[model samples]
Target: MDPFKNWQDWRKNLDAFFGENFLSSFENILLYNYFPQVNVYKTDNELIVLANIPGLNDINNVDVFIDYQSLELRGNVNLKYKGFKLIQDELFNGHFERKINLPYPVKEDRIDATYQNGLLIIHLHRLIPDDHRRHKIEIKKIEE
Candidate 1:
């Protein structure tokens, strides 16, 4: 409609395209942006989540937990700089958060987590139900 609107749309399109193209590079630049890497997988009895959190020193500062069906991870980054002059900055040096929804219920009490080499690994086991799911099937005839 207007110039501003046209520019906004064009910017959004450009961002989407460039973001996809540079995703790999962006992921590699965690020191600048604090992009937390995440890997999720599941088995019949367990679900695991691995997150890459670099430049974090204090374990108490990082808050990691799962509530209900969603896993909430959040933490504030600590800057490790000494008499540094402003030059170029693209990395997000601030608070970060990432949420992931679980497909099935996880055992909250049986969670195992460890943070090493800027990588946070979390392990969770599934809680199975006593009752089994029941399903019904229907048949249809072909018509000419």
Candidate 2:
């Protein structure tokens, strides 16, 4: 091993490999990740999901959906800036979407949503079964 392989040389090589705007691009990717952070909770009769979504200007623009097996959230973060040059922006912008798998089937008609303080809360009611499947039949003797 050569003693000339110093920390500064390694850092320079890393910087060159990743390009001059590497850090900013990496930060942007992290900030605008595909999925928003969410928390899920379940009770005996319902399931609730809370998602963190800052920079949302209007609640009506967000869409929420739920089916028997999954839940989906989609929205856009509209940020309007004047003639000021953006030096470093780490906040997420544009359309954001997230889908979550539910542990049990849910009634789609009973779903509700509310947004407050940069968080969106969704409520889903569990589906109830109304049918019983086992029926007793008389056994017939097999003829040889």
Candidate 3:
């Protein structure tokens, strides 16, 4: 019983157990965990978010929710080829939900979203807090 032959047999058994495409399937699972990559940008008075989501048949089907300082996105990517078998699939397909925290609170009514060329762009205005309600306290020195 040669060590090299035994090692090769063990590896073959492991590969058979896991399947030949096990590694690719595992990578796809990990990659799709954060599907539709997003980028957030902050300006002086607004925030801009860009999301890469393709294969959207209808933009109206996607749901976008904005809270005071958080944004939620829910959508699905469908790419079906009729009468054709999938040889390789790198694109994400199915339902996905992602929540993002904003750097500052945003005004719910002042948001605008648009989808163009597979990119979802959102513009949100920053919510300004009222400064008039803030009160300053005076310090007094005391003698012991």
Candidate 4:
């Protein structure tokens, strides 16, 4: 009594028993996201995330904050074109806030952010391990 299994096996049996367009129709539905698209990248010593926020935010209004293990991106997307009606309105407008869970805790004090060409680029430096903080080792010579 497993409710869900492999789609390939389930589809063949379900379609023959039911109908063909049932599954195909489900795939055609459009997906919507409130926040703009974002991409995250990692290096050995740092984490970089780029958010595509074109025509939505300015550098002064954008805010970047981190607490413990998560980074919160809260900002206002200005709807400058609010009064004008659009012939073809595809872009989303209004307020947008996206919070992302960071893989590693960064140096909260040394965070940097830059916005250029309608893209918000956030840079955070990784924190070094406590054990590696002190590299003092004791050397002993063997007494024969």
Which of the numbered candidates is closest to the native, going by highest lDDT?
Answer: 3
lDDT per residue (tens digit) for residues 103-126 in model 2? 788997898888889999888899
C-alpha lDDT of candidate 4 relative to the true structure: 0.70
Scanning candidate 3 in windows of ten residues, the lowest lDDT window is 1-10
The lDDT for every candidate, in the order shown, is 0.72, 0.77, 0.83, 0.70
Off by over 4 Å in 1: 1-34, 132-144
TM-score of 1: 0.64
Off by over 4 Å in 2: 1-31, 133-144
Instruction: Write candidate 1's Cα lDDT for 1-144 as tens digits.
Output: 112325446556766988644444543463343256577888888888888777787877789878856788899777748888758655456788877777688877889989998888888988676677766788898999
Candidate 2 overall Cα lDDT vs. reference?
Answer: 0.77
Model 2 worst lDDT run, 10 consecutive residues = 1-10
Model 3 ranges with Cα > 4 A deviation: 1-28, 133-144
For residues 86-144, could you state the per-residue lDDT of candidate 4 as single tens digits? 68645656666777777788888878888888888888888776885767799999999
Q: List the residue pairs that clash in candidate 4.
A: none
Using lDDT as the measure, name the better of candidate 1 and candidate 2: 2
Residue 122 CA displacement from its true place in model 4, Å: 0.8
- Model 3 scores a C-alpha lDDT of 0.83
Which is the leading candidate under TM-score?
3
Provide the TM-score for each candidate, comma-separated.
0.64, 0.67, 0.71, 0.64
Find the number of clashing residue pairs for candidate 4: 0
Kindly list the per-residue Cα lDDT of model 3 for residues 49-119, writing each as its tens digit.
99899988899768899989999999888788899998987888889898888888999999899999999
